[model samples]
Target: MGQHEFSEGVEVSHSQYGRGCILDMIASQTGGIDDARVLFYLSGEEVTVPTYSLAPASEVTSVESTRGTLGTTVTIDDGFYTITVEPDGEGTGYNLSLQAGNAILDQAELSSDKLF
Candidate 1:
């Protein structure tokens, strides 16, 4: 519910399901987490579990985040949605896009307001 404390790409462990990666969180009309789609590693099957039923996997050792440099694009594609980040054509900032299926969920230009 509300904004999820956990996000996509987080590895989670369930009491009944063992270890898995969060594929997606289904959002209700009210913008709360209805449930989570988790792909259990042992079964290789996606399971729908309540958001509260999942816990962060403690066995996670390291995490490597990705970022795109100028004139390049970085994309993260989960089965449920895709997020893309690229340098804005104007050179002022980066363009970020979130898309699900063929529908664009949101797009924005990201930049810092501080002058260095």
Candidate 2:
């Protein structure tokens, strides 16, 4: 749960590619490394990069936080999705709601034990 992990339609700058918008963010498995395969609009090629390497673009809107709790809303990439974290009785329990413009596409209830 780092800041700006990756999201669609977010503007960003690359070390080599200069400037681009993130078209997609897909999980990649190489050498057992959980990396993010990002597609940049400028290069038009999907490349894997560490989440820490990306620089946020000034134009695209994003929400990032080091601290979050119930009723907290985490928005990413100009409203591509809104993730809500709900409170639960168990200290480790987590209930998430994923929304797509007033339409909830998915919801899940889990505990810290379920998530590594």
Q: What is the lDDT of residue 70 in candidate 1?
A: 54
Candidate 1: residue 56 Cα off by (Å):
0.6
lDDT of 2 by residue, 1-116 (tens): 24444577766765565446666565545443344556766458878776566777554356664345453434453434467665454566767777756889899887876776
Per candidate, the number of residue pairs that clash is 0, 0
Once fitted onto the true fold, the runs of candidate 2 whose alpha carbons sit more than 4 angstroms away are 1-58, 64-77, 112-116
**Which residue pairs clash in candidate 2?**
none
Cα lDDT of model 1 by residue, 13-107, tens digit = 77777778889889878877778899988689999998887767753223234654556667765434568888786667788888865899999
Q: Candidate 1: which pairs clash?
A: none
TM-score of each: 0.46, 0.35
